[model samples]
Target chain A: MADHKTKASAKTSSPSGGEEAYVPPALANLIGYYLRIAQEASFQAIRQGTGKSDLKPGWYTLLTILSENPGVTPTELSKLCGRDRSTLTSTLNGLDARGLIARRRKAGDQRSYGVKLTAAGEAMLRKLQVIARAHDERLDAIVGKDKPLLMTLLRRIVDELGNGYPPPPARGLGKTSRTR
Target chain B: MADHKTKASAKTSSPSGGEEAYVPPALANLIGYYLRIAQEASFQAIRQGTGKSDLKPGWYTLLTILSENPGVTPTELSKLCGRDRSTLTSTLNGLDARGLIARRRKAGDQRSYGVKLTAAGEAMLRKLQVIARAHDERLDAIVGKDKPLLMTLLRRIVDELGNGYPPPPARGLGKTSRTR
Candidate 1:
């Protein structure tokens, strides 16, 4: 429906004017529908702003979390990202290969290590953050003063829906010693 | 943050209680951050409810569109889904392989075909819709009377952000003859 970004007046009408707007019948009123579309637009805008196609969908989330909570173990990172540990390991490997993150063994726990973004990762994140902020600015421009409420609403949806879903796999991390 | 869904009180506290809540400082306030989380939850919920792990993201959107716009060309489907043509073809092919949708050449335009759901496709969609409606009800329970307002807000965000992004690739479809 948004394919014609330039033709503001033709929001519905095709170029030939042979058809009316195609409002997705079942999807028009669904919250998930809007969430999917809006998220796609937000992601595209950020990708365009960053000019970096190499970073996959969840990379920024990983980088941001690492930036805030440095040296979080793989299991902890998996829980935070809602991704399985095996997938998380490969993602960490990709970042590590790019020299963006490093894994270091904990002083007492010789078997387990923590993942943290390296100086290079920090630089990449700084660059990405500037672009992300600009994207947020565009979103802010749209929502204006309702931004906080929108954030709350969005968070509420996440919280309520996630209430009874399967917990992220802690695997061999054990019940008592699971990383926070 | 939502990894411990089974323990309602542990929204922040881990089992050990040895650590305080770990919040991604920068992402906590961002709209896209919440959107990503909420979308992930919504997708997971629908996937679990439908019991179909193979549908893949965007497949439902395509099926929904085909269910509504019975004769939309591949190009039109691509624009509606915000995906490029090549990727759209593969998705359509997947659905075709599953006997869910059929492509019929348009009358007088043998070169072009309209994509629509088959009887089996319609049956599958009916089953999925029930699950999706339940998911939407959960969203409704969360937002209540604000559902309409939330929808408007989400649409506004989609429209405003989509204003100047690159148009979905409509290669060879031509500007004036583009399908609606």
Candidate 2:
């Protein structure tokens, strides 16, 4: 750590000092502020955990979705994840290129298709499940009470916020380097 | 809504069907998972509430910190906010451009300087505090407990994560449009 600091200092400047965590007076209680902190923590954990994998940030969540909702279509997947379909496409393309997922057109509907986990995709998700479990355990240590109470609260916010937001048709063929 | 769908469909080919929110298998329990959902909600709420203001998603939080820790330097503010100084420069520059913040070097301390809320900065924060308060009240309605418990749990997670992440020095001069 000290060595890195010295190297970094040599490149530009000295270390920033006197950083007592300032819980922004009222911002801490604003729900959004805490949400950013917690989400950033989760993002970091995923980045660290999947550092060696080809999977992008938030792709594990997509894989988990495909694992649970096997045979789900891209549109369905988008709605399930609340991510725009344009966003889902690039992610889908990457996982597809890696042989982790397979896309199959529905028998009658040629334009739309179902997304399935290839054997490799399922295998990757299983490994991620373990890492995710560890992440959950770490959070469990902090949140306590198994998180149902907290989830219950968060779910309520999602429910109320979901109202009146139009679901859009997803654009096809976009780059999918999801950065969490 | 229909028009958006029509336009989107025209571009995308067809409507995607069957998007029930897929609860991520076993990950719904992770505090981070809940954190993403909760954060998205707060983000949407802020988008709705402050749609007219030039304040970007996170600038409000930065402003709140400066409001609380008046006369803090870039290094100290970086520490207080758990962000690298290099990351803070653009954000500081933006607020400074808006005439909401001021920075000055300390006597005998050429490198370190203090950041204070300009009267405009204070006034904007005061206005934002009201909007932020109303945002909190809506969340409080959803969380049902005014967030002491939730904030405490999240703070714990932030504290645990803060350790081991090296603080970097703030770069001298650059564009400071920090998105995350």
Give the per-residue Cα lDDT of candidate 2 at A8: 25
lDDT of each: 0.71, 0.68
Worst 10 residues of 2 chain A by lDDT: A11-20
TM-score list, all predictions: 0.77, 0.77
Q: Candidate 2, clashing residue pairs?
A: A90-A176, B85-B170, B90-B176
What interface RMSD do all candidates show, one decimal each?
Answer: 8.3, 9.8
The DockQ for candidate 1, computed on C-alphas, is 0.31
Give, for candidate 2 chain B, the lowest lDDT window spanning 10 residues.
Answer: B11-20
Candidate 2's DockQ: 0.29
Q: What tens-digit string does per-residue lDDT give for candidate 1 at A1-180? A: 234554432333222112222358788999988887778667766766655466554577789999888999998887666554666777888899999999999999997899999999998888778777877887888888888778888877876776545443334333353346
Per-residue lDDT of model 2, residues B92-174, tens digit only? 89888999998988987997789999999988887777777787777777777637887777777777654433333454433
- For every candidate structure, what is the RMSD over all alpha carbons to the true structure, in angstroms? 7.2, 8.1
TM (B chain), model 1: 0.75
